[model samples]
Target: MRMYISPRAPKEVLDYAQAEANDSGRHANHAEGSCFPLSWNLPPGADLGEYEWVLNGFDTKDLPSINLVPVRRDEPWETIDAHLNRFGAEYLLGIMPTLWQLEVRFHAALRRSGIPVMMVPPINLASVPSLFAQFPIHTVLTPLRYLPELRTLLPSRDPHYMTILGPSDAPIECSPGGKVSQEVHLVPGMVALFQCETLAARPTTGFHPSDRFIWEWENDRLYVTDPAARFTRLMLPRHYTMREETCDCGRTLTLTEAV
Candidate 1:
């Protein structure tokens, strides 16, 4: 079995994984060293398809784990409220297909401290202002297509937006006008176990590439290579123009603009 360490993981954890890989005669890749390998080949009879991605935090089995309460679209609001109140939910993470259709009462039913984290697709941009006024949504995860409208609609709420390529993938961009960041997972999967993150204060339209992965631009296309990940040289679908100069915010991380 191949194990990749998260960039945020403690030094001891990374060292242990490296030591184990070395002892087992498997090649180990780390962010501190040279660029990752470009090969995408797998060993004969080795199948990674059966392995499910899991995030293993520092805690052991004895510690209390996170409880995720799933709510169906057609489920009664009373039942949802009961579950939230029973679990003493601190936040609401919802996937809404239509933002305008969501009742304001649903948000009002939550406790005062229960911030909402909403994930929505490209919806009618006109409803954005009213939605924000009615719901105290702390964070929004949406597709790239809606960013231009969101930027205009929520200029003051710059730090609350994240751009996602798909439901399973990690966010491509986070907090547009505030601190821009992205996570590079060690293994390419819906859930990330080992990953590294890149952060910059007040980035323009792009982010700096983390040392955990190597990034290349080919004809306006962005391709990333994660040494510890199973997939090699994944290309981003978006076309971007690169800028090497310092940003107005004084951050020196290389910036890119979606073109």
Candidate 2:
């Protein structure tokens, strides 16, 4: 699940899920969101070389229509050819900056890839109730580092933690541009991104409002606010990894950790 979730009440999501189950009365298991990112349902001992995680982008000018079946929109087809040609990409990762154009790009990307996408909405606009009348959420980013401070203030089950980055079943290196400069190995769990977007068109039972933080992506900061909704912004540097450190030329890898 992404760090930020829809602000709609959690119960509403449950009710929606209960009603959406198919003939089998089963809903698809939810994971993080991605547009054209590759997905994997690997079994133990399965060859990792069999799939690829495709990443792609599009312009806001031609956002397609994809409501119920966002994955069915027609793309130029050549868009993902590079990722496809590279091989084993069961996941499709898409980066979309426009909200009005999001649903369209998401649906088309989903349909074009025929796989699930990891959705990570920016929490840059996030704000938490202010503890001090004199200070603002904008001043809290660099100092707040653990979950206790968060739990005591926000009233949620998910607390904060140190971000540590490393490898998995295989030793994946997170940077190539110099380990310290490019590598950001965050600790386990999600990186809190406050200041999320407005009401999500679709709600899900997977997360609670208090459980996650919001982000103001454009500003690259986390937003916190007091009851008055005044703003306090914080930011944790985002972690990244290198291709060579992730998977071998013929291997598979999962881009996770403080994600």
**How does each model score on lDDT?**
0.39, 0.26
**Worst window of 10 by summed lDDT in candidate 1:** 187-196
Per-candidate TM-score against the hidden true structure? 0.34, 0.20
Per-candidate clashes come to: 3, 65
For candidate 1, lDDT tens digit of each residue in 104-163?
A: 333444433364544333455666666667665554444334556677877776433333
In the predicted model 1, the residue pairs found to clash are: 6-194, 6-195, 7-195
lDDT tens readout by residue for model 2, 1-259: 2222224325444344334433336322111111212222334574545322222212222234211112212322232332334333454433223342343444454456564553322232123432222222111111122223443654532211212121111122222221111112111111222111111111210101122222222122222211111111222233322111222222222222233
